[model samples]
Target: MPWWSWILIWVALVALSLLLYVFLGIRLFRQFMATLKDLGAAGKKMGHISPLEQAQTRPEAGRPLPGSAVFASPTVMRHDYEASKSSRREQRRLKRVQRKTDRGQPQALGDLDFT
Candidate 1:
């Protein structure tokens, strides 16, 4: 109701708003720095697995090396694709032959060609 009270109320409101913004800004800055630190660490770990080094060595379970698709030649990719396809076909043929033998059924002529 008094004139001075109106000025005091506005001053308190402005000070509280400024404090909230400063706290929020500080929190945001800390989070951003943490994110950058994590990103750098991950980059260093992944850098240890260079494309060339992985390509020269084989991984377990016929697993392709990481980033091979992005860095490998087209011919290399095609060879890998064909090899995987042929291996699958060979496995299927073997399973079919075994199943037929177990059942006392005749085998197909294609199954006999073990090429």
Candidate 2:
């Protein structure tokens, strides 16, 4: 009702909003720092763990798990071969289209200088 009372209410609201923002910003920064620390430790631990994993297994494990290779070989040998040929054709078509597109576009700065 009073003008002073309204001014006080406005001041209180602004203070509260600023406090909330500062609190949230500090909390978020702390969380981000904590996540970075955790990720660093995890990366370090993974490096150690990966070497331990490799050492724990026999060297032959890298070759094959018995007859599993017989089944896997045909899939690898045939599956991608036809797909690779098709992809080669596709790449040639894409290169032709790209050459045409490049002819129409302005050259970049890097293209003008080589060193």
Which numbered prediction scores highest in TM-score against the true structure?
1
Residue 16 local lDDT, model 2: 100
lDDT of 2 by residue, 2-115 (tens): 899999999999999999999999999999999999999999887766756766676563244445546776777476566778778868766766775678965545334254
Q: Which regions of candidate 2 fall more than 4 Å away from where they truly are?
A: 49-115
Backbone collisions counted per model = 0, 0
Per residue, candidate 1 scores C-alpha lDDT tens digits across 1-115 of 9999999999999999999999999999999999999999999989889878867776887787677698989998999999999999999999999999999999999999755
Model 1, TM vs. native: 0.55
CA deviation > 4 Å runs, candidate 1: 51-87, 96-115
lDDT score, residue 53, model 1?
86
Residue 10 of model 2 has an lDDT of 96
